[model samples]
Target: MPKVSVKVKWGKEMYPDVEVNTDDEPVVFKAQIFALTGVQPERQKVVCKGVTLRDDSWANFKLSNNALVLVMGSKEEDVPAAPVEQTRFVEDMNESELATALDLPEGLINLGNTCYMNATVQCLKTVPELKNALLGYDPSSGGGTAGGLTSALSETMRALESGGAGACAAAAARLLNALHAAAPRLAERGAGGQLAQQDASECWTEIVRALRMRLTVAPEPNSKSLIEQYFGGTLDVELVCSEADEPPTRSNETFLQLSCFISQDVKYLQSGLRSKMAEQITKMSETLGRDAVYTKTSKISRLPAYLTVQFVRFYYKEKESINAKILKDVKFPLELDVYELCSPELQERLTPMRNKFKELEDASVEKSLNAKNKSHGDSKKENKKRSIVPYWFENDVGSNNSGYYRLQAVLTHRGRSSSSGHYVAWVARGDAWLRCDDDTVSPVTEEEVLKLSGGGDWHCAYLLLYGPKILEVPEEEEEPMVTDVTEGPAGNPPTALA
Candidate 1:
């Protein structure tokens, strides 16, 4: 036996740092070298056979002090060439490589990113059969383990169909649950399936349509109950003016002036109505008093023997006469039927003004009817034609107030057109005398004027009083009408209240 010395290098860059001792017996030497260097004993064989002494022949060897000592022999043969060193390295390991080596389903391999891979794994866990299939044993395949779990599911469904009932229920339930869980994952990947994508698109389309409809038919919140029966809900509202070239002006002055207008409507001057109206006026005065001026004027016209009551509410930050801060000047033409219930003397005195008022109201109604009739024939054509004279007041009042009153007659125009069977109303509030004969003249009917005098339109009037006094309207009680039991076949009586 010959002894040999061995050295081992480890890691990427070989470093000459490890040495091992071999015994005289090559087998024992190899084993000892392997034990010391932790290299395979078989790999150390080449070193065992190549040792020699100074005689240039095979050396006899023996172990001494954990090292090999060689003894020269009489015969020597060609020394074996030093064995070439070889190293083995395993290929780098990763998810894809591991999945491939284990023969996993290609679907899992196709997951583009780690997030999707994790999501899919989570979804599959809920399906016991699918999980088992991935783990190499598929219950769906009739007690045999198969790699084609998807195919096994399909075959199971087919068998259930052939078996005539209930065989696939549990599997179907599991698949549905899996699909539901996986849907959100697919959406994040922007890979929503065809059916889901279509449903989402349709829902968005309906929402857009609803918004457009609301914009078109704007409705107020207070009007909700009245319109909801027909329109179903409140609508989005926006205010638009006709003049495009002239931008509307708004200021704190305008706000105060408008507040004056609102004050006049809230305050009623008639003696009989004063107490109830005074309370409202007082409330409104508190809100507008800081920036507004209030004045009242009464004129007696002999021809009509009627009282011309004028209330002017002016609002401005600076001190000035009411006429100096005029934002709008409108003269409302009104007709009163004093003859309907009045003394002969009063009627005689009112004859001239009453006649003039009636003529103006009639002429205004006729003109409006003509325009409406003309519009009916060709509304599109009529819309293109500009009016030569604008009837309604066309001034932007310089105030932020919601209401005001000026020493101007406010007219209410109303009439029924034969062509379009609906009552129309037009209110004009200005300072000039109404000229009825003019084609542009706008007049208000008697009923409309009364409505305005009684504190705005019907709705506003109802709201003003409905708040606290609604409980005051006495509920009517009806007396019951009874029918005799003899007349009703001796069992019961009939009552009208029923």
Candidate 2:
């Protein structure tokens, strides 16, 4: 029995004038078709004039005694159109299926199912061996195209021959062999296969182009452009840190710590300069009277340097009660002018200090002028006047035991008092010095002495006295006063006799 079968229709029109014979026994005929056609003759039925016709239907016909035949119609004109005989071979075989039918592996079918069998066959036909096989012509025999069965047989032979050698190899090896066998042939004539290859290559090219573009494009800079573009930037000043001579790490924390350490060191230096200045001022104070104003200029102009000097103006204020004794309890305004005389070297060193002082003085003068103008424009009557006096004490009086002395002075503002008595007393105890004549000395008057001991402003006759020491006097029954004396000629006191 054949492994495959096909059914073909035969009718009156196919042999209209042929004789019929049905006397002999019919011979059963069987045929094989391509396995892909799926045709079977045994399963088919033929109808004639709305009646089913079997082999027995022609049993009574007679012509030649040994021949057997059947008529499909009574007359030729009554015959139906010749039954169409469609060849079932190669109807639905895809390239892979076709390859398999010829005993070839799936991988060898390069055109896949994307191309028609004819086109795929054409592609395969480009290869000498495959073309010879497809045309049923032996390449060695040098024959032309053969019939259908011969073509199929040739193809089967070719598939077996090409694939047989690699059957024992790994599956991948067999697949690679098949692909190599089919690729060249397909490349020449498989338009669909070639299109797919072109499309794949184009896709890969686009992907590589995209990746290259991404790599070549420049990235944006990370830092701020304003400083770089305009100022030509700089790194912040940083201190060098060492660990046994190792260079410092340039991190934010290290930089901050270094800055703090430097600031503290500066403060310490400033404090030392102040102490030294205080010490020098004390030694200078011993040589001058308490009320004598001494002036010393800065040796250096900058802060730490400028601070090392004597007689920098220091001022403070205190309130006085109405009933307080002015001679004993009143506080005085004191002023000491320290001329800042800088040595050339010191001037250069203290230039920054001088600049700062100039700035402060200008600001202060402007403020004072504005205040004065405002006060003048005010309609309210002025009852009291106030003034600020800069003053400093001799070093001996300072509590620091540095021989720094305290000096006191008065800022007296006279105003109308409603009381009958024309006097006010304001005094308090702290430090005191007297200003008299060209020379400043301690006072001799008991009242003045008491006021100095009590400490503050006092009212008294203004007398200019130039003296270096206080006069010592014993306690007496009467208050001491200078008695007026008469003068005669020759600047002599008048004689009692004459």
Candidate 3:
């Protein structure tokens, strides 16, 4: 099915150029309508050609181009609403009111060349656990630069969550001040006495370090902090000697984020990550007591709830005296499966949950297909036979049950070097995305998000955030569908509406 532009008539208001993707469930279309009309999906009654839209299927209607959709439902608060003439369109609303009415997250104001910090802040805020931990952090108990940084960050996050433009700037200004105080190099001034552009990845690392030092909300009993529990992953490392006949040395190392090293052969994020897992290094062997070549192998021993992947695109160029960037297009997936990248022990632990996820996904597809053919009563009966997939671990809130993750946020840069580029944050909001570009936040699509994967002078993905992929089994009982095509002019054409 193709996407079609339809005119939506809600009361006397006629909204033109409304896009409907017939391939997706009607609920997704309802979400788009809700974004425009402020009517909840459950409350909406979209009718076309005498057929009321169903959440499960669109088999009953053959909607063509310029088809008219009559949306008949008032917002819950506006059930006893007055005339439609009194209603103001989104275009007519003021800036603050528009942001409020659209339910957009506040964007950070760039204080001079601080887009890097702003972009990093927006990306990190996509993790709810981290935000909650920051909000609950006590700066008084914490000490040193980390404490002040954490305090400023908590305040900045609070303002952003507050959904007010004014507060966002004030809080962001304080965060910038805190950053300058903590790291003077970040606030380095140029010869012209202007604040220089900083590296967004470096800023992200420093912020994560500060949060790990503070924000003491342990997800599990013996865990360090919320940052450690949610963002931390373990790598099982093995070093094999090439010359000596010594046993392989094994060790476990923890990491908050993974570094993806981009080489000529690395054309995808997975390949870059895999390349870093095994490499040759010169080290002294205990058996030989001399320098020897060793093959270092590493595999993921533990998976985190939220995984951060930094693209190592910048390299120090001594000739240019700058951090040059690799503008290679490294493709990444929306849904990433890392079962093969994990150690045998961890893979064994993840198999059950991964199997359950596959089962649930297949069942969901089957249910969606069956709903188009089955009667409403049959659909309701099928709900009773549904099974639940139990959590993989005792404390699974901030942990990955299966070795799968979905892309949540992407931090991108748009220049030749990290120190002289514009940074932006593209964060997932339900099925849509929000592009946070220094106090200018706007809606974007997943396609647009994927296009950020570097090739040219466009915004290239520098940092990627992946969250645990959790699948939910949907209930069969859907909202009541209302049928009324006779009220609209487009539906009541020369031929009778089927």
Candidate 4:
């Protein structure tokens, strides 16, 4: 729920105006009043006119324009405490139980209308590699200021590192500090306790930029930064015109994300990417001395381990002064295969890894069928499947294997325009999904995550982050027997011009 500002008057005294979210329960409202008047919430009953509002929630109620509300309750009341029976502290619990109790990745509080920042942080937090990289960063590692970005961001990441242990009470505060220090206008909140609605991708881009500027740890020794280490890829764009006499013009570009442009012919995400990669347009050709039709095509020169894909759904409408949405239903896959999207050389290099994935998948399917058919002997045979590839690539800078990726994190929006919408993050923690909407975090299912494909203006996927598909390698494989030809025949040498 969006935050709102309101005023409260008690008897002859007027308390300072405080901001509260209208979507929250009335108990939270009472807690706010308790801070101002030093009154216990359990003993307080808020009244508007002759009606006493229920303390459960503030539904169907408006608190706009600093509306005044009357309160009728004692300043303080003494209450008895329940008797204690059993108690278990961290000192007594094992590591697993302690971790469950702490739950390291806690939800961030929405400060006023900072949902965009909260959502962005939540989505990025899903990346354990990023968190581990941040944990390696120290404030004393580098000096000087890069737009005052490093100091604030490093501090924020430090706070986030141990969030589950309750060591940090203000993850949102640290993030807002970093954001304001880096880009003031992006973190600004206007009047009415409402912020200028921001694009989640824009915010996401800026946050990544900040981290790139600060945390310089690389996955590999010579790699640039963790941003490039995890999310960087190179694109090979080629331009060819039918009227031009010379060979096709080719160039390279770096990208952190690929935009999938929706079109009439785009029925799904793969097709949308295809439409963006290859397009025909009219351009003047110097060799032909006339405007000619040109076809521009792009392919991946390098595939990063973690891939980011943004749906090009919002565009600026100068007349409307807002980014209007396309609202098209773009279907994306849970496990994506990008083997076809790579350059010829890269595709050839990736073939071995692709074959290993196929072998594992085939073995898995066969095992499932054998179990259903009560073929335990065949199941054991299928269990002898051999792995030929490593879980990760030797050089972690590029794709691990098979050009395959699993959907990891999704950032979503819930309005028609980018400037006036709510942003949330759906993150995958192993097999479970967490839908993080500002301070309200709930468990969701994969089916619910798939429904965010943008059709009817509900929360739809705006940006997707994919991680490399990890494969287990077997210890050994069947090797052919080597025969000594010299032993077979006295005059025979091992393959001497045979």
Candidate 5:
């Protein structure tokens, strides 16, 4: 089939010279009509000679050159409730229109070598709790770097939310100023007197610290600050002196992030994390009365709703006077189960939720198989929406119920070192992912994202943000709806189908 030029008629207006390709899906034809009428494909209803057009096929209708077709739908803004039926890119729709139609978040513009800051900002915006805390932040709460950063960040987030398809350099510039003023190292210039590119993980740490100072709203009554509540965790530490005949010393420490030291043996993220958890160090031993070798062991006693993991890929090269990166291929999982990383008591506490997750997975497999068997032909399987429950603990609002998490964002660095590299943020958006390379935001596949696991000069994952995995309550024990009744006419309403 060949391309045919047709004129489309919408309510009172007519769009002529619209090109439609007969060989492609009918949705493609709708896209052509969308280009002319500003109506999204999902909301569009195409009719020709009283026969309706379906998205899957166009076999019933014969489209010819100069043929008149009827299209009906409101503009994208008018139908805000309509779901996105397809992925539309810059080639299909302009940036402004794409943002408006898909409700995609705006991108941040780079100010000189500020991609690091931009990437961090974009990744942090994925956290709803943090954004809400920032929205309620008061600059008068404190004075100095923390206050300035809080104020700047609050405004930047607001602008990013509402300023669609617009430049975000001004907000980013204020943030850069606040950060540079707080951390002098970030303000250092290159040999050419140009602003130096900084590390995204460092930027992330400083911003988290600043927000922790100003956004003091606790997740629960009489708790720590919002940042700590959502991002902080506790580690149970034990030190056994090698030369002393005494019991091991025990203590607890709070941390904002976990570091994964990447060595030659570190082939996966979990392995690196486990190696860091226990190590041999030389420290002052009170029992031995001297500096002695001791075995230091650490286990997580508390897991926050949001977890930050940094790959220790950079090492200081004294001769080169630069931090060189290691290009090792370390695989990471999209869904992570950190049960092995928790303390014994913490692991026991996390068991119930972990069991529930296992049940859900089993049931999901069964349901999928049943659906596949019931289908008459080789029809594609329908992607069923999983039942979602709160990721946080029921008793603790900002703590994880299970030692499981789903990767939400990844900050990758390209080039030899963090100081002279490009930084980009890859954030999960529903089932899709978006790559924010400074000002340019584009859709990327999960495979593309996973390829950032190093092994080459390509972009490698430097920092990862994992949010607690959404628990799916089993159908047998699903919470009863408000309409559920103990005694219904239809024998208890057939167990109130979930």
Candidate 6:
């Protein structure tokens, strides 16, 4: 039996084409169709060349390359009426089975107004490299490449190593334990029955602090901490004014999280980030001897593999003595290009990788066109591996030379204020989107993730984690150009010896 790549069509729509092995049970093939079509495996009716494929036998159909398939099925099965005799809660269900069946990351239990904490943890957990680093690093050893960490929370972090119920819980628990060590009162709820709310950004900082000190960059023992490896960035900030006599001032600053300030005109996430960098102020400068106009500009000195951008939608309202949220629509792109934010030198350094990325995009388009027209068997074999592994750059410690990033996780908050609002995390795992709202996790779509931008504010994206975009390059080298010995010169071809 041979594996055949087939184009599947349902009704008038064409599903993503798939490659299937004719040797496996048709059920296995059905599952692949399920993932593509949202049609349940049990209910699918796959027809190829006027033959209805059977579950047990795939070989009997004699399927081959470029085969056309018609998959007929429903999105889901009809459920019977619920039994009124008994009521069940989430706790009553089997946790392991529920989580395992859905392949969900473990979720954290919301401790009062700890949704902020939970949201941050869930979002950070989406970084596979960070997770791998956490899984390997020995917290008790008191050894880290990043020198700023304190070993005070060593025993607490080690306790998290024992076991956890789900991925969310494991990540949140470790972070919470570390946070508690930093400030004991943070984990406790005050007299108002509801737990006192803490700033989500503060939670982010402390959690990253613990991780940076505890986690080591294995390759370089004392290079930089894990936090710096993924999130750290340096920016050159310049202050200039309209006055000819006033000299401009410049300084450098480090940042782990970039902020986006929302305003009346702000309708997109990237615009908000730009607004945060440009500061317009009317102030009297003592050195300038009069009121001077000043505007601040900032540009990236270093770009980390993971870029965390926070939307600064909250401001303290004096009337209620509480932090209030801005409900404004800010559309954020799934793929972001930060070329404009980089310094001229860094931008020049990025040109090669940027060109490589453009070449990859061109190649992918050509490949898709080739597959559509050529109908060659080799196209299926060529696509077997999609992920681009062993990706690298020259001097690649903390450089996103391509300046391209794909959104991997989003932390969103709903309601008017930081303390009272609910928080959720939308994480991209493989090609699927999963929304983790405290303990309840459900599969979501890219469209749903997009809708998180804050118009009417169901859930507004508060923070975004963007990971480097890698290109899938062909592993095989191109054949060397054949030397045309017969053509001796450009003007004429030399006569070949008989």
**TM-scores of all predicted structures:** 0.13, 0.13, 0.73, 0.70, 0.72, 0.68
Residue-by-residue lDDT tens digits, candidate 1, 392-450? 01121110011111222231211111111111112222212221210112232334333
lDDT of each: 0.24, 0.23, 0.77, 0.67, 0.76, 0.67
Q: Which residue pairs show collisions in model 4?
A: 104-164
Can you write out model 4's per-residue Cα lDDT over 184-240, one digit (the tens) per residue? Answer: 677555464334677788888887886665554433334466577567888898989
Count of steric clashes across candidates, in order: 30, 32, 0, 1, 0, 3
Which digits, one per residue and each the tens of the lDDT, describe model 6 over residues 16-45?
A: 547876644465566566556656544678
- Candidate 4 runs further than 4 Å off: 1-104, 142-161, 164-169, 189-194, 218-223, 281-284, 288-293, 372-392, 396-398, 474-498
> Compared with the true structure, what per-residue lDDT tens digits does model 2 show for residues 1-498?
112122223442232232222221111221011011112222324333344434223333223322222222232235478744444355565454344344422211211111112112222222222223233343343212212223233343355336332211122222222222333232232333221221111221222222222211012324222111111111222223221232322322100000001112222222323332222111122323233222222232111100111111111223532322222221111221112322354345334433434565686588677765666535243333322111101111100111111122221211111111121111111232222210011222223433422122323211111101111122331112211111111211111110
Better model by TM-score: candidate 4 vs candidate 5: 5
Candidate ranking under lDDT, highest first, comes to 3, 5, 4, 6, 1, 2
TM-score of 4: 0.70
lDDT of 5 by residue, 436-485 (tens): 88766777678889999999999999999998787645344653331111
> What is the Cα root-mean-square deviation between model 4 and the actual structure?
14.1
* RMSD of each candidate relative to the true structure: 42.1, 56.4, 20.7, 14.1, 17.5, 20.6
Better of 3 and 5 by lDDT: 3
Question: For candidate 3, lDDT tens digit of each residue in 1-498?
Answer: 479999999998899998777865565576566656767555778999899886546878677789999998887677676664356778976565456548877787655578999999999888766776666666575467878888889888888877366556556766876777678789787776456899998899888887776655433334466677678889999999999888999999999999899988999899989898999999998788889999999999888878999999999999999999999999999998888889999899898778878887787798798777988897677667332332224344456768889999999999998889799999987667888998778776688899998999999999999987764433342112211211211211111100
Model 1 scores a TM of 0.13
**lDDT computed for candidate 2:** 0.23
